[model samples]
Target chain A: MRSHRFYTPWLLMLPALVWLALFSVWPAINTITLSFTNVHQLTGGHYIGFKNYWLLWHDPHIRDAVLNTIVFMVICVPLLTFLPLLLALLVQRNIRGIAFFRTAFYFPVIASAVTVALIWKWMLDDRGLFNNLLQTMGFVHKTVPFLTDRWLLLLSAIALTVWKGLGYYMLLYMSALGSVRRDLHEAAAVDGAGTVRRFWSITVPGVRGTMILISVLIAVNAMRVFSELYILGGATGGVGGQDVSIVMLVQQAASGSDGRLGYASAISVFLFFLTAIPLLFLTRLNKNNQEES
Target chain B: MTATTAEDSREGRKRRVRGTGAVRHPDRKGRSPIFDAPTPHGLFFRYLALIIVLLISIGPMLWELSTSLKSKAEDVYTQNIQLLPHHPTLGNYGEVQNTIPVWHFALNSLTVAVINVTGNVIGATLAGYVLARLKFKGRKLLLGVFVATLILPAEVTIISKFQMITSMGLGNSILGVCLPDMIAMTNVLLMRNAFMALPREVEEAAIIDGANVLQRMRYVGLPSVKGVLSVISIFAFIGAWDDFLWPLLVLQSPDKLTLTVGLSYLNGQWSHDPRTIAAGTMMALLPILALFLILQRYFFRGVAQGAIKG
Candidate 1:
């Protein structure tokens, strides 16, 4: 009777396990196999082995994409890491109206990113509110093209990324913050530690696990940035204004009327490797940390 | 008889310790003159910082609200600087409805989102329970795979997944969107965590009562994880509704589009029409806003608990 009971679970699980294998594993294998072929025009393909990858070295767009993605990550990751924790700390206080402010912060998390990029599209125009504010404040004599300027384009997108993303990260940190023992802080204060010192010594170490989690999340999300660039229309070589992110590069490659699936597949394969490296390290780190705890 | 003096001394020490800053932290600085009461400066500064964080976080959304009311020309010129519309009109909403079948897209979005939510709720709960309570083979490996998948960006599997959909003839259909999302990894992990926290004695009692696996789960486990299940429902809803990439890949037909993809079409047409675009954006936002407001109590609490458990 117990044996029969045990068998029922395996029977129930078969469908879900099959679904996972079909959607996730099989498709992943296909992506790997497809990357090895000269699948440029889609109809017929020869398995060209490493030829496609070798050719990638000559592709300037891929290089630019790699550079652009790195630049975006370098500029965005640290700020994204610390800013949310700071915001979470600020709001974790038992202050009046904190709940209202927290809700306000969460609005963008529920809003569509496509819509966010579009709304910002209008706001970042040459005569948009951003420039108008600067001009009104007498900060600049001429309107600054924050969106279109070659130098400022990535920065503009970074601002959007941080704005849209902070609340979600803040929530993650807030949860971690809530779990810290109150007595620990009291003990630190009694030991003559100041606010900043206690925060660095106590709060930072307490939230190290969350820091790792957010790092992995930010790194992965950085590599997959698309909707914002798509809304920007990618001509600017920045975000919506003029700069291009790597995801835009992939979208163009994949969906181009020219049907450069081989090229696109190659690009996707490269990204797969690029993303896999960080993921590998982070997962291992997570495992080791789990074991330690 | 000798115990009276010792008891009195202990009470005096307790009073002194309680009177210290350990019980209630006092701000070293004096209270605000404007408020005319002694509120800690630390608390005041924290509130101020949070307000700024809130503004930066939600400024664009509030901007969207005001921008939708302005005329197209005004958006081009003023952006979001103008607080109230100089001339507020419902013409944009009219344009959105007329230009595209907004209600149709909403219905499609709602259908897919609800179905996906139901599927996730059932699938994740079962899987979570099995992983948590059942001593089974391959459980640890499966859990590891799910965690790994959380870090595997969709772009990695996007093309192949698209191919799978096309091959299965699920492309351009709502089922395509719902099916892939139904078996989400994060929800599984969340459910596992929630199920792990369930008291062990309840299940043991059910076992002793000769309950079958299904009966035991229904009678003992499901009741305890109600909070986690609600969180899963909301997470599934938000993910399905706000999802653009997968829908864009699978559903090409404008008529069969979800709200996110449908809004993209309106946006493409009205790239210059601020009111039309904002109206469409607002329409996309309303259902989610409604869900959040209606479930605000459950939503935040679920978020608070879910983050810790997951």
Candidate 2:
């Protein structure tokens, strides 16, 4: 190996190291420290030792957020995990003008989360296209309050998340599918296997590891739902103000001039642990996978 | 010839198989044989599924575009839904600006994206080169610092970041909004991977020629990593442009707000007129969409490489 002066590598890495210290490492430590205090947006405070966590434990908003997060995860993990694999399979084959189809599907993924949510919000407005179409078709005379209801608002956000997520995860699966045996389905077909049958026995097992990784990704992403719900359910979580997520709770606690920075830090610590469960599970699964392999 | 269509009609399919549904593979004619030549029914269902997914993915954005173009004469909301506008005009786009400084906010967003793109490209390139190519002590430990942060989702650290920005007197500033993400660890690691893939023979050859680290990197490493550099820059620009939560927390002044923050403000403050909101959304969307369209080859390639390596 070619030797370098002791300061050379350090010189090259200085900028990134400064950024890591200032942004990632320091903030991680400060978040835990600040959670023990009662800091606001404008004021610093002495440590009260878990009082903020105590309040968070009893907060009704936290309960609503927890319930909403669970709902978001339960629906999203299964749906996002399976649908994108089919989408990848659809676009993976070489056919006429396949490149155009592949890029076009990823448009929603490229668009900002705010823009798509706004587009969806406009479409689902009381007199918007969907409601208007329903009324015109004599399906319903009155408008549906999709954005105003608690459960519907949450569901609408989940739908938007899945819609935008399809192309992103499709890309991931597309890459993973590159390694799969191309002719296995044909062999399985001679055993009288149907399309779904081939998918379960062949494709699913082939990319079982990717599926597990994607499920963990979906779970973690679902827990961090913000822009979709924030836009669809209004700033205060629609009418009932209860269709909120954990990240939404973080934003609410630490936003505006009267923001509770300490309380928000506590909630953030909670959100961190919430996301870590899946990540830890993934690590454990990976270890098991390694042992088997 | 547009990139949107499933198949352009001008490229004639000479096979002329009627109703059997096997459209001749126009491009990739040679490799097509090695790939599965789908039967007529299979081709039909595949294209059908492709069309359906295409609709579900982009149909709303199209509807939003159509809604944004309708003139004042047309009733936006009616019992009989009319997708085709009676009269189309660009007035709603102007209305979005008059109500809020839409272009000004877009300019601010561009500034942030430009700064971030520049920062990530230059900074990550240096850090990645040293980490991957240079021999140094504690290099693995330095890399571990970068990898560990990937586990901490950016959002969880927002509270502390907000605190630090305020403490640094960067609150309500664009610099504050752009700082934390300027050298994202993901991009750095990606660049490191790219540099690592460079052939060791060239580096050895460069050393034999008495080329220092800078010259060796510039000649050997830089040229190969250019593709990945461009890919990460595109991602950086898009991330900075589309970002919401961080900008929302750090920026408070109406004038300094990015497009995302401004668009949301427009939603709440000018809660009337769906047309104007749609117009605002389009303005934030179109620039990045155009960039992605032009460079989608690189985008797909980058993501595929990223997925494989990751």
Best candidate (score: TM-score): 2
Runs of candidate 1 with Cα error greater than 4 angstroms are A1-4, A40-44, A234-242, A256-258, A283-293, B1-38, B71-81, B268-271, B307-310
Best by lDDT: 2
Kindly list the per-residue Cα lDDT of model 1 for residues B152-233, writing each as its tens digit. 5678777777667766888779988777777776777788888798788777877877887777678788887787788788
Off by over 4 Å in 2: A190-192, B1-35, B307-310
Q: Count the clashes in each prediction.
A: 9, 0
- Candidate 2 lDDT over residue span B185-259, tens digit each: 888898999999988888888888888888877888999887788788888899999999899999999999999
- Candidate 2's interface RMSD, please? 1.9
lDDT of 2 at A272: 97
**CA shift of A142, model 1, Å:** 2.7
Candidate 2, A95-138: lDDT as tens digits: 89899999989899889999999999988888888898888888
